[model samples]
Target chain A: MTGQFPDDLPAGQPEQSATHPLPAYVPPPGDSPPPDPRTAYAPTALIDLSIPRRTHPASPVVLAARIVPAVYLGMLLPLGGLWEDIGLIPAFGAAIATILIALVAAGFGWWSWKKLTYYLDADGDLRVDSGIFQRQARRLQLSRLQSVDAVSPLIARLLGFVEVRIEVAGAGDSRAVLRYLTKSQAEDLRTTILAKAEQRTKSEDATSADVDGGEYDPAAPPNPANLANQMDGELLARVPMGRLLGSLLLRTTTVTLFILTVLFILFTIRTQGVASLAVAVVTGGVPLFAIISEFFTYSNFTLSRTRDGLRLRNGLLQTQTRTVPVGRIQAVEIVAPLLWRRFGWVRVQLTVAGVGGEGQETGRAVLLPVAPRDEALAIIEQVMPGVAVDDLPWVSAPRRARWREPFQWPFLAWAATDQVIATRTGRITRRISFAPHARNQSVRVMQGPWQRALRLATVAFDVAPGPVSLSALQVDLPTARGLADAQADRARLARLHQA
Target chain B: MTSHVHEVDAAFAPPQENWVRVSPKLITARRITLVLGSLLEVAVIVALWLIPGIPTWIAIAATAVFVAVFVWAWWLIGRRVRSYGYAERETDLLVVSGILIRRLVIVPYGRMQMVDLTAGPIDRWLGIATVQLHTAAATTDAAIPGLPPDDAAALRDRLAARGEERSAGM
Candidate 1:
């Protein structure tokens, strides 16, 4: 256990020497153009300069995959009894019509695939052109790109194609999405874009005079952090099947589903002379399906460290590879459900910005969906480098906190490091939350009638554009007020340093 | 049994005594709005009473309850207006208000994403405006109402400038 993270962490930190050895902070050459921090896109080694680049179209199999949903809808419409009033002959005719409709949908899918093309422009913006009839083109500046994710569904994986999504900050809902590229091509493209983004940030840092740059050339040296080379790749955590299943089965959702299934079986036995197999099948099948779906979604989960931030890859049926930049994560939350506490397992989630796009589940927020307590803590330490979660000093809740929230008081505690404010709460599903001081938008101290009577208060630290359930709950009134005031000051100082 | 990680810092300094009160015209603004609101309530009740099938006593009782609430609210509005006070600190701004549930919000200037000065029709008529400070986190308590229009603008500019200065490191 070397506590130091990898060498790819952003510059200007004194802790770099403790980690892997890299070049000291070097200033950019004076003669170079003053880099505009906003549009400082510099190409990394990932982009193959020798190769002649042209617009690439998506794989042809994507058309068949895209029309699957429409085919299912068509099949379900007939079963829904849409033609019940009409004769059986008419119903038969409707079924044939549905098949023709499915064919037409497939044709459109083919046309869409043909129309969608992506290529990098001279200005370094990734230009995407799409639309079968109406032309739609979007230019996503590389410097503004926040994240690049590669996802492969079961069908795509089988066909060896992957979908790449590039999220651009301030672009609103119009992020560039290149779908169904060859698996290798998608991987290569993702690395190139991420490397370019990192290079852009380095140039911005140098020109903004934020970093103590000397002669920092991003292209120089055998920089293992180079994205295309992937020389500095280090596996941080891996969730085992046993632990994943244990955490999944012990979840509140699974427990409630199991209880409902038993109740349904009991009701069926009482109402019918014989046990109704239909009720048993219907009630039991849902939870089973949900468990299987969860298993498929998070199986083979792995978290790795890259030069940019963290890289996560998981899923059995639909594998997804996502990169979360160091600055993008606003907060971190670790939850331990009632059953999970016994086994010492926890689920780690993060509050990230600009990644939750249309048609994407915010589930991308989970950094480590399920891991052991020690591993979870380790992941926290690595993701939030320089903040030691293990040795943090907590301000324990008042002794009478138990009288108020009996089962939870023991676990209720909060602490503040130089960079983050951390709080732990809950009884059944214990949650430990950490909010970076620079990212926190405001601090509030609240007192209800009962709490006021008890001279107690709760303090909530809110972050922008993310659901932050991070709070120091049920503390002495004066303590809550004191923390709120001090944290406000601390946050201000951190923001000043950030600027 | 206790392991001391680090000594706690000095206790937080309480808000300064030099708290500036909001404009007194806030009471007039509240009075106008409350009177008009109560009138609307009365109109609704009278309409209900005029219905043929409904008993007159039900509407009369509702009107009585409304009257009692209006009087209580009218008195509370004055106190609420008087309670509003704010203070500027070295790095942050403190806003204090509320009578029953005493509220105190401390928003650092650097954290403010935007500072807005708004004057509604009634507020404009009274020659006053409200200054709102917004952060990435939505904190509704960060508004200071009943400032003179010029004062509100000055406050907004000062806060915005401070926000920019503090956000440079960010």
Candidate 2:
């Protein structure tokens, strides 16, 4: 509250600090020999003892997972060029060849288990070396390595191993992926590489020479910004059941299934029962689909903090993993949908510097599926420090509501518009309730220009991700404009920094 | 070599023969080659139709469309490949490109994450290669196109060295 950075944050993870201290990083030795072939170019830490170790064959079960690829390739080959009319013997032979190729590939898949060995050089590069038939040694100098992505695949999940992929600079999908390693091994590998890079850097320059030779300036610790470790709670919001379920039903496949089920039941029934069953299907479908949709939308959603980047892993059938380094996030925007406006919730997205569109791996990266209204501003504060979002107090706006009550009917003719709660092609969709929940409290105001001139205010209250009807209080419009303007000004102050 | 300098690292010096620079001229030539290649493709399609059991009108329509598309494509591809330009700035590297949406990407010197120097068949044929610059952030990545082999390698080496230099805070 003193407007000064606290020496200590609210709290940081004890385990995170003990395991990931910045000062002691060293790289593991990989394939490259340590004879100083390219001069004393990189530091000695990277030139560890064991780089050219033997390739450990993959497990047979690893190949079993590859059945998906084999089956896909098997179907594609005959259609692609293999089974063409080069005579029945050749065609039949081609089919046989396809199976043989699949078998050989499956065997190779089992055999090509890989471990990428890495270490940090004194100059601050995380060098990785790995390959099977043809060994490829890739050096991602510390500065160029963007994100260190760690994931647990279905196999790794059960086997207690984690796969790590390094996102490095340059083009054409250059990444060093280590398929199977213990969780501890990955953490060590990450530490060693970064540490070596930092050390090598220290070894450079006349001033650095004195520092590396060993002098500890407590005030200017090696990584003075190491205190940034205290910054946590990057999580913006949690996606609740209502919005998640609503979105699922909006998908084409789920709706199509419902339509199909309706047709199937109607035909199966007799004439008298047909109409009743048709009504029953429609009545049951909305709630059933909503529940099913919620189940589909957020089956296993978890966002976690890594040392150098943010890791997002999600999916129902095919799990996808994406890691974004702090440096790459461009613009962050929080959008509150009409449903969420009812709950005062928002969805956060970060614009990333890249050609690809949004995905776990793409731009305007989704930060949180959902979060509370007030928490949105707080999350933005930690991730992008420079953007200043003001916490201001202001008036509210008036909304056009359709009503037939004695006082409402005549007032509806000259209603203050532009305050839409839930609109379908410009038509309002009424809701059951609009009162704010006991746990969730927020100040709301709405205004139109004319209403603002008359000092009118319309207050809307809701506790979930949808507009709550019959709970808005109409006052002067000027109060609504003042409040809306203040909020807009606060949003304008936020920025999503460029890459 | 200029003498009198003491304790110089011989590795810093350039070789006796100079490396040819890849110019915009070859980019134009590549575009021309594309036109020729398209013509040859259309000719093959026409040739197939001209053979004894095929219809002439189908071949005519196909060749007509191919030629039309090729004619329209020449200007587009020429301008796009022509617009691709790369230069090393004091602070970082710049790659400016685009036919429709102009883009001038500036990768800061200190932020460069990796440089991958590559030469495929077409590059070897043209006596040129490419350098891809990647960053920790996926979005800020760029490729320096069409440098003569030695120049590309030298650029990579320089960038790698500079990358290390800056990262080391030197």
Candidate 3:
């Protein structure tokens, strides 16, 4: 049987196996047979969440998200008071209203408390139930569990709690969340989930090997990261403290917060009345609150690994915990924010079978909030030992030229018209800047109509390809042709390796 | 009984689908019908103007807005109609559609995430079903339009039998 970079073919390309090989970087030949995870592994850890659960940690921010409605109603109580004075009354009236609001808050708090518990059944199943208003319960057999995710809000840390969500695969989506599991519980939960998935994968490898009679790589020795680095620990990377804060302050919510805050100030200035003053005060106070809260939000973020899988933990107010087995990861993407171009802060996220599908993939399950270059490398090694990331030559895929490429006629056609119309309205954009991206951005070739006019199209690659990088091809016409040609070419070359 | 008209024409029902076909004419007719609808809207604005009690300015402004909207709607419909196309590849089925950001989704026969045939009121009149194929990567949702409802339903069933995956994601 062949080993050692089987088709070590050219760059940005892999030979599709004459037979789809077990994912790479697995270990060498083993002595005895392995087990079948599906059939042999215990189903104790598996579970499908019954419904949506409240496993979100009670981070003041998350709680605040839920509380926005309540807070709005409370302030508007005066409006209701106007209605009451206009002769709308009932039994304990305002008292009842007040009680109702209080009850809703109390109800959510109670449910958050109750729904936040998650545990594994004996056979390696992970189960979670959450939500007070709408009770949700899910069960995932441990074998199919995709990833263990933990998000620690800054508040959770000061308050001593963390939120954990577990994802799984199959007929129905089964998942569990522990909103405010203790740090220890969060760690334990991740460990247990990882342990279960590992067990199942091990069993599957064993059985599938016996049945198929083909070579399969067992997992790398349990602790590749530590073994590779020795006492140096995980190599580390980070954006400067200043750059990180800049990004946090500029995220979608932060931008909206800033915009509203500015609008409130403008209103406060325009009308020197109590109503305007109150509006200004509330709006002005929010961004400050957000800035402060976000400080602790990403505080103490850390990522490392043991033999089992990768572990990430961080938060100032609320702690979040997440675990992902290397086996579950479909691919990884290293992303750079437009602003981070200055500091070179790259965000790393993974695409796994279960993550990044449907759920916006909340998928950027951040591995490193900010890191030095070497640190990111160390982390990559820990998560994926066989597939290399650091040393390979990084080539920017061809899709970055939307503004200059001849084929960009379509987008240009739209852009030119849009510019003219906006200019006529005196709303001209001073500068229309296209984002500068790195080579290796995920390039995908998807052919729809224009793509098919020439029989090609491509999706821009988002720089890094890890476990879930399968979808990031640039689907431009040439890329599509390349894909078709490459598939055939790779197939032919793979046959040579086998022969 | 089990499938088609001219596509097969061996004397069989078009097929089974949740919604019935309105007619193929709707594809092109809708374009003309929209023009006709815009004319109706124009007639309404003029009637309001002619009726008098209504302010002349409001009628003019309303008519102008309606005309702009009608033109915009026609543009959207034109683009959407033009973008719709589908083709079947051997081991996989391909559906091409999308207006502004066009998409061509390929679902290898066995890689179907989920296939659903749905019909809307207008589509009902057109006798067609919009079939959507879900994949793990939602950005590439493959959809084919204008299939006779019955064929759409059968294709949906066939895809379900052949399609791979959980509805949530990939």
Candidate 4:
């Protein structure tokens, strides 16, 4: 039955070459291959919920490593000047104090690690019990599980451990982090959680089948074995190192910095003296840091399709594996910078419901950092499934709107299909955002004083916060009203159809 | 002015002219708050005037500005209060407000996560309350203020029931 899905594969395929690496699932040393689908629910040794599990024993070392550098720098740098004034004995005492602090932090870390234990409850809810004094116990419902990501910071990677982050729907703090698990253990845990979550979702769907008018078949439950073989999923897109670097360099900020640096050098030479270059350094440093960070974050970015959802693996210093479940994406945006357009490149960003607040440095919202136009469209199609990007009945903003956004007016357009509402804006960067009608939270029509005078309005389709922002700017008043109303109606109908 | 009103009506028209206008007492409530705030500002300026070496003209000018602003706000309050209206459609709730930046927000019942009913001291005294609809997206700012307590409660119950029936997962 699992073979019907072509992407699903049998367990334990040989690792792919290093050039295009895949997350090869290596089962625990003692356990055999995953059991057959027809068998009753049997917890494997790797994912035995009856036993409470602890992270790697080196968890204390990892915690100490994270804290020691901050302590050393914070104590040593400020005390360096004071040490000259205070004397050698006190300086040595200060150094000893810093070591004591580090030791205390490590001790606390060890205590917490020893105390912390996580297990899956009978209802398939993940319960994490921790805190030395408070004894905090958190139960995360599997039914609301949005995504499960395995993240490895540089030090954690060196120590052969990964942090499994589970994000559930609702609230900013709706996330669970299982820190410092072995790489294989993290993989197994992610697979088990996702499979269980899928089963829970299927069961819920079955229960709601009456409301859904028998749209969901209760008989066809997902095969956990197939989901465990996520390693063998087909690769959809992989960003090359060269393209990632090129895209970073071609950013508008990089260009502006380059121009500023040249002007600064020329001015200095003309003055025939070393001028105050504080302004130049301050201006150039931020973008340079941003570019370097972006490069490190997006290097070796690979996106693949799994039975559970779409899996994204990226990062140089801190490798992160994020799975965005099927139909979980709320919105998608494709951005093509002016410079990148020459190379036929664009970047794809997504707005998943609960996968937010992880910060852009993790590239959580970035679907593709840089891909050719066609490849970008193909990836968007996969993410949004059934929406045609190239072909849409686009309606450009009325001619009067040009007065408001003179340069961007020509590019300002909006399109509404039965499935998605898309808006295009920006003259230089050229951004096109698509929000599925079913996922739209609300519709808004707004008009500023100037827009009122110009008889123009802007319509916005709201979704859960991420990178994608969909709005039709400077549209004619009647058209904007019509669009908003039609969009609301479409959203209502789409929600009904989905139910 | 009539033409402007017509344009606004055309732009933000609900299915019909069935918009349930907010309480008229909202204007009085807002004006009282505005006057109190202005009086506080004037008091601060008068206190600064009592300071040694402070110019009397500065305090007088500040007080005059506050008076002008207070009068302007008082004049605008009624219009702004009148502009605030909400319409309950079959599947969504429409909230239209703001004079300078006219906005009409339509939040589908299925997307509503929570319905909050709140009453400030002045609102409680005036027998009015605010009903705020929260969706998954924070940008969905749909708050209908200055509804009579009974109406607010009834609206909250109706919205809650509809939200439950059409509840969709984020």
Candidate 5:
């Protein structure tokens, strides 16, 4: 691990971790283990428990497990006349080639693991340096650290090792990953990092308050923001197995497949033909894949709020844990599909910077797969304090706008406050999206000829990663203009003096 | 026509008329480029007609359609260029364009991440440049084209200064 530094460090300087031996950062308030006296005596950086250095050994056995899949595919592929012509010698040669390829892959994996290393720097930043040839180093400021999670694959679980993923604020695609740490090391690192981040934010917030003459708003609640900042992995929402299964079966794909199957059967009986076999197979395959996808996505969903931000963990075969920093979330959305609405359940999703999965791993954008409506609302309140979905004065489209959406526009409405602009749209599914004013990238008011004849206009608020625009169609033009001006002013003020 | 008793006001009417229109010279510039592009299409089709055993009528129809489109486009070129306008508001910049599918984009000064000035060969020949304002969202259409070089430079500087001051607060 020390050998991989290459040119990033000077020649004579010893490892920073060995010299500092970790400091005495304070432990978090509740449910944290009592400080162990062994490392707690540091008095400088280890206010919390100190994590001892542990490296994931380069074990070749883990990659050797891949031979099973390789052998299965080798047998599955050589099925035609090529097998009949091949004698025992050629067959044996193919098997040897597969084994050789698997061995090479396992060797590469082991060598790569040998190069990865992570340690706490003297400045309390978690420094991770990995890469066999490129040798990249990442230093995450403990204060800017958001959340850390311990994940275990099937093999890793069997080996009693867990991978730790560290999420930081404002860094795009730069999350630190330390793979195959012992479970205790992963857990200890997560707690210490989160606890130290919580402590730093509290002190920073206090200092800013002092800088502003300590004039706290009398009307506001007594430090809800600070309270939210101090959370230590409180469970916010958990989806029940029954609701997950129910939501999976209740999707529109099921109905579409049923209808298509019925039509194919009817046509086959009438014409005594099998030409529709391809159609039937293709139509039937879609719903089956959807069911399998939902099962894997929402099997054991759990959402929690911690000092780091909102934490979401779900998936059955390959679980993923994502933490989005509180400040980095551009918008929040509560969506209730038509079928899910019958059971009074809604899914809460967020558009967060870095974690919205612009390209890869799209499941990270979802905060909750399926939860009771009240629970989803509660989780929103937990993440975004002061902004309540029910308290805002929602203004619906005017009565004249009935010509456009006979039933939906009456339910569609938009509301804005100093903190957030919330829009409620859709009739059957019913979605309410909330975006903070400071995060708004742009806004537009558009009027078409038909809409102009009715004095209706649409106002769109362009927030990154989320494009749920709010439209008050068929309202008087003056009212639309006034609302646009007011929203522009409010958004400008929010951006000018960010809190 | 039967119902002048509508209770609503005209929503399509913009609030103000202090909009800055594109440079009138842009019309001549675009016409020259359009004619060149049309001629290129005609050449490609006539080349295909030169091949033996190919239908001569096909090339004739293609050439005829290209000339017709060129003439029609030349007629509407002035109104299309005149429709492009932009306004600098107190907190946001409003850009309006298009004749059929009218679009209005309002970009708040604080949200601007970059202000770029670009001039193509034709635009430089016409002594005009285009200013593009890019925000965090990639989907934003916030460019104002066909401005005099001096005016474009002034606008870019002002937008850059305002962007700096506003982003500092964030």
Candidate 6:
């Protein structure tokens, strides 16, 4: 790594040219020098900023392990055809070429891993520089950092390595990943980064408060009492393995598959045949895959709240630990599928700012995959203090709106408290979404031709790009307009109060 | 019809109808594009007609339908352009548009992330530009097109200043 830096560095500093163990590159003017590598590179260093560091040496091996299987799968059929069409010599040559390609890929991975370096700059912005041929540098502002996730895939976990993914605000391209770090190193890095990010936000708030004569500070830390539960973090909720599996079995897909299988079995018995049962078995694959994937993704799911933010840990095969700052959660949603409702079970999800938008990794956005309604509500209360879904003054959609959505119109309702705006929609799979007024980006009232004819409109409270879509559909036009205006007013007031 | 229009306006009307309407030149610019697109379609139909195995009646029917659709769109363009309106409130901006599916979006100044001013070739030729207001939410599609360049610039500056003053971190 030291040798590679000099080749890229501009020619200068002849005095330090003779086999200097560290790169001789100078820090930017007025900025502090990089920390000593010996101290900074220590595994136990808490806040190792301003020092370029490489991931574990096993990064290349892990990358190759991930890639070789894909290469083999892609080349297998073509190589097989070559073996049958041509004789043994050409087949052997193709096989050799494939091996050489895989070897070259492994070598490239090693080179890229060697070149990749990440560090925190003087401004506390996380910078990652990677790519062997075309160097790609990404700078993520710590102040805008949303979440830091440490994920370990099955192979990487077996190899005792973790990947750190940093999610920042704005576009999808703002995300940065540092792959294949030792598990301990990744955890320390996450803790240090989250702490530093919180520190930066607090300092910025302090300065802004000074400018405003210490007026309301929206970014002020949440309840100090809550802060008392820091460091170790209080485990808010943990789903037992049995409950998780039970929830998976109770899902609509599994229930529907069970029903179909039973019906197919009865039909097969009547016909004295087993051939059509194969159709049911084949159709079962869809729900089977869902169950297995969901089981692995959500098994042993646990949520805890620490000083830095909310922490989530889950996954059996590929474990992930994500830390989302309290301020980053734009909206929270509670979904109760038709089947789960009978068991009083609900799934809690969050729309986090700076995370991936629609169709993001469901595991990351999920707060609780399956929990009793009361348990989920308890966690929600902890996450968003003082806002109770049941206590809000709910108003259902007007009866006239039923023409637009006959069944769902009854479920379409909205409530606005001083702190948050909540919308409940859907009939079969009920969903209620809560978004703080301060977090709402905008509000919209829309009317289609049919809706206009019925004097009805849909009011949507727009939060950051995430899965939690908070909207009240098919309300009276006046009510929709009023909601939009009032929500905007409340959002503005909330922002001012918070500020 | 007038009462229906009034009812529709009442649903999303600004406090006192202080909406700043876009330049009427928008209709002309849009009409130009419409005519150009129709001409291209006509050319394609004519080419098909000249092809060895195609029938003349098919081309004629295609041209007739295309003309009818173009005429409908051309007629609707004026109302659509006229429908575009925006109101600058004390703390938020309200943009109302769409003739058939009317929409009114209220974007708080504090939530605004960017205000973009863009002008296409035809719009520039017409001396008009578009001002797009972006909030943290990507779903907030608030764009006021066919504004005079000076108005667009003025709006952009005002929105940006307000956004800075009322900066609400996401």
Per model, how much of the real contact set is kept? 0.55, 0.00, 0.04, 0.66, 0.44, 0.74
DockQ of each: 0.34, 0.01, 0.07, 0.41, 0.37, 0.40
Candidate 2: list runs displaced more than 4 Å. Answer: A1-50, A53-61, A64-106, A110-137, A169-174, A197-299, A304-329, A338-345, A354-362, A381-499, B1-170
Position A387, candidate 1: lDDT: 73
lDDT of 4: 0.76
- Residues B95-127 of candidate 2 have per-residue lDDT tens digits of 655544433344554556688998766667777
lDDT tens string, model 6, B4-113? Answer: 65666777897665788999999999999998877878789879788888888888899889879988999999999999999998889999998988889999899898
lDDT of 1 by residue, B46-161 (tens): 88788888888888899899989998998999999987888888788888777666666788887787898999999999999999998876543599999999999998898999
Q: How high is the lDDT of residue A434 in model 6?
A: 89
lDDT of 5 by residue, A1-499 (tens): 0011111112221222222223333445696556544333223332233343435563444545535465646754664335446644545556666677768877776777777666667766677767778888877765555556677767667777777777665444447777667766665566566555555555556655422112222233223223223333456688888888887777655866868977997887898899886677778777878888988877788876543456677888667766665666777788887888888888777776666222232122788878888877766765666677888788878877777667777777788987888788877778898878876777666766676566566777777745344444444555765676677777777776662
Q: For all candidates listed, what's the TM-score of chain B alone?
A: 0.82, 0.70, 0.58, 0.86, 0.82, 0.89
- In model 1, which runs have C-alpha deviations exceeding 4 angstroms? A1-58, A65-114, A144-151, A160-225, A229-232, A271-293, A356-364, A402-407, B1-14, B47-60
Q: Model 2 chain A, poorest ten-residue lDDT window?
A: A418-427
Q: Candidates 2 and 6: which is better by lDDT?
A: 6
Rank order (by DockQ, best first): 4, 6, 5, 1, 3, 2
Top candidate on DockQ is 4
Per-residue lDDT of candidate 1, residues A11-83 (tens digit): 3222221232222223357864564331122222255523333223545445465556566566557555655
Over A1-499, each residue of candidate 4 has an lDDT whose tens digit, in order, gives: 0111122223312222222211233446677445433221223423776578888788887877766657777777777777667666555756776789878888998999999998898777888999999998878877666566778787677777778888765454457888888877876687678677767878787565332112223465454443344432457899999999999989876888878977877776787666536656766787889999999889989987654466777889777666664456778889998899999999988887445333231223678889999988976665455577889789999998889999999999999998889999999899999887877889999999888888889999988777788899988776778889889889877877766
Give candidate 6's error at residue A222 in angstroms: 20
Considering TM-score, which of the candidate structures 2 and 6 is the better prediction for this target? 6
Runs in model 3 deviating more than 4 A are A1-288, A306-308, A327-333, A337-342, A351-362, A381-499, B1-47, B55-83, B97-110, B150-170
Candidate 4: residue A162 lDDT (0-100): 77
Better of 1 and 6 by DockQ: 6
